[model samples]
Target: MKGTFPIEKFSHLSTPFYYYDTQLLRDTLFEINKEAGRHNFHVHYAVKANANNRILSIIRENGLGADCVSGGEIKAALKAGFPADKIVFAGVGKADWEINLGFDAGIFCFNVESVPELDVINELSAAKNMVAPIALRVNPNIDAHTHHYITTGLNENKFGISLSHLDQVLDHLSELKNIRLLGLHFHIGSQITDMDAFKSLCIRINEIQEHLYQRMLIVDIINVGGGLGVDYENPDRNSIPDFHHYFETFYKHLKLRPKQKLHFELGRAVVCQSGSLITKVLYVKEGVNKKFVIVDAGMTDLIRPALYQAYHKIENITSDKIEEEYDVVGPICESSDCFGKIVSLNQTQRGDIIALRSAGAYGEIMASQYNCRSLPKAYYSDDL
Candidate 1:
C-alpha cells in the first residue's frame, strides 16, 4: 500500500526529518517472527540497519535477537531491552575494547572473521577465565550477484575467512583453548533478490559441513547471514519481504544436521519500508536544458543516492497537480548530492512536501554532517 504521510501534522514540524510508521514496523516484525518460528529458526536483527531507539525497542518486543556489529550497537541493544544472551557480535575489525566488551556482556556468539581475531578473542577470554563462544565466518565465495560494493562472500572480499585457509584455521583451534567454536557463519552479500545465490550458499555450506564433520568439528549453529532484499521501487506492494519463501529456501536446500539451529542476521529488509525521509522543496529552478527540484535535505540527511547511486521512490505528498519531470537534487555542496534524475512528481512548487520512500534502512543512520548540517530528527506515526 502507498504509505500515508500526515501532511497537516508535518506542516508545523521541521523539514528534513524521518517519519517512521510504527504499525508497519511492528507488522513486518510479526511476519518475520511467524515465518522464522515455523522452521524453529532464530533471527538476530542487524543493528547496523537502523539503530533508532524506538525501532530497536519494537524489534526487541517481537523477541528477535540483536545482531550487533560494534560495541556501541551492543550497548544500544542492551539499553533497548534486548537480553545480553540474544546479542551476536559480528564484524571484520573488532578492536580490543569491543572484543572485551563482547566477552564481558556474554553475547550469544562472535562471528569471528580471521585467525588473528580468533586469537585476540581467545586471549581476552583467557584473561577473564571464560570461554568465548564463536562461529567462524567462512567465505563461501558464492556470488550473491549484487552490487560489488555490498558483496562480501567472495575471496577478494576481506570480510570472511577464505576456503583455502579453513584447514589451517581449524588446525589452530586446538592451540587456542579459551574460545569454544560453536558453528559456521556465511554472509553472501546485501540486497540479494536472487534465491539461486542463497541456494548456492546452502550447497556450499553442506560441503563445508561435510568436510568439517570428517574432521570431527561438529557445529551447533548455522548462521546464514541475512541479505534479503526489500522492494525499494515498490515498497507498497512488497512492504514486508517474502520471509516464508526465504526461510523455506533454506529448509528445502540446506541439509541441517540433527539439532543444528539456523540463524539469520537481517538488516535492510527489516526496517527499510517502515521509514520515509520527508523533505520540503526549496526552489523549482528552470535551467536552460533541465529543470531542477531542489530540496532542503542533502546528502547529510540521506547519502544512499550519492554513495550507491541508489533509487528511492520519490513522491509529492502535498500537491495533486499535474506531474512533471524534474531532476530531484539536494542542497549539498558536492555535485553528487542529487537524489534522482528526471524524476516525475506532482507539478513542482516551493514548499511542497516530498517523501523519499524505502529510506528506513540506510537513510538516517548513515546521515553525516559533512557540511555541518543538523542531524535529522525522527517522528513516529503513532505519536503524530
Candidate 2:
C-alpha cells in the first residue's frame, strides 16, 4: 500500500482507475534480481503483464530484460528506454512484419514455436543477410495444473513445438542458413499456484534436455519460462511472489551444465501485488437474503474476473463498518461481468472506495471499451 491510495487525493478524479504501488514493485524486482543472481539466472519482464510506462521504466532500471509478445510491446519497451539487446520476442503466431521489426532492432532472441514459424524467421534473416539466434519453444506435454485457457506447454495447447517434432526441428536447423539454434524454451502456463507443478516441469525439462543432448549437441541456454504465481488470495500477506522458492526450485531440481544460462520470463509474479483497481461503489441493492454492491468499474477495466473467473481480495478502503456478505458486481451489461460472487466485505454504501487487490499484473494491460466506456486511467504513487 504505497502511501495508501489517499482517497482524498482521488476525490476529484474519475470513479474507476488503476492505482499502482511502485514501492512494492521496486521491492519485488529487488528480490527477483537478488535471487536470480544467486543461480546466475536471467529474467525477462513479460510486457503483457502490465506494460504501464512507469512500471516498465522501474523494471528496466533494475536490469530485468523485457519479454515482448507483440510488436507494439517491443516498441513500448524500446520507448521506455530498455536496451534492444536485453529484449526477447516470443509468441505463438508472429507476423512477418513483427519478425522483421525485431530482427531490425537486434533483439536478444526469438522464442520460435512452430516449424513454419522457424522457416519464416530463417527466410527473413537470410533476406537481411543475418543469422538470428533462436530458442525452440517446446511443448513439454506436462500439465501446468492451472487454468485450461492459460495452460500453454501441454501437447494440445497450441503454443510450442511438440516432442515428436524435435528430430524434424534438428534436421531443419541444420538446413536453415540464417537461424542458429541455441536453446530450448518451455512455458507451462500462467497464474499457477502449485509449486509441485513447477517441480514437475523441472523434471520434464531435465528428461527433455537429456534426450536432446544424447541426440544432438550445441545446447547452451535452458529457458524454463516463468509461471510462478503470486498469492492473489492474500495480497497483503505476500506482496512479492515467493522468489526464494521459485529460484530455489530450479536451483535444486534443474540440472544445469557448466556455463549454461537459465532464463525465466516472470510476468505476474513480479508485479501483480503492487496494483489495485480503485473503484467507487455506485449503489447498494438489497435483495432476498443477499446483497449486491455495484461499483463504477466494469469488466472492461479489469477483465481477469470476467474473462478467466479470477479472484482477488476486495476491500472497502473508505469504510470502517462491520463485515457483510455481498455480491461484488460491475457496471457492465452482461451477467458474466461480475467480479466476485458472494464476497464478504464491510457494509458498503454509495461513494465507498474499493480496492480490487492484486490487479497489477493483468489489470491495466487488459483495459478495454466493450460498452463504449472510457478506458480506465492509471496513476502511480511515485507521481502522486
Q: What is the lDDT of candidate 2?
A: 0.89
Best-matching candidate per TM-score:
1
TM per candidate comes to 0.99, 0.97
Clashes of each: 0, 0
Question: Which runs of model 2 end up more than 4 angstroms from their true locations?
Answer: 1-3
User: In candidate 1, what are the lDDT values of residues 143-226, reduced to their tens digit?
Assistant: 999888999999999998999999999999879989889999999999999899999999999999999899987799999999
Off by over 4 Å in 1: none
By TM-score, how accurate is candidate 2?
Answer: 0.97
61, model 2: CA deviation in Å?
Answer: 0.3
The residue pairs found clashing in candidate 2 are none
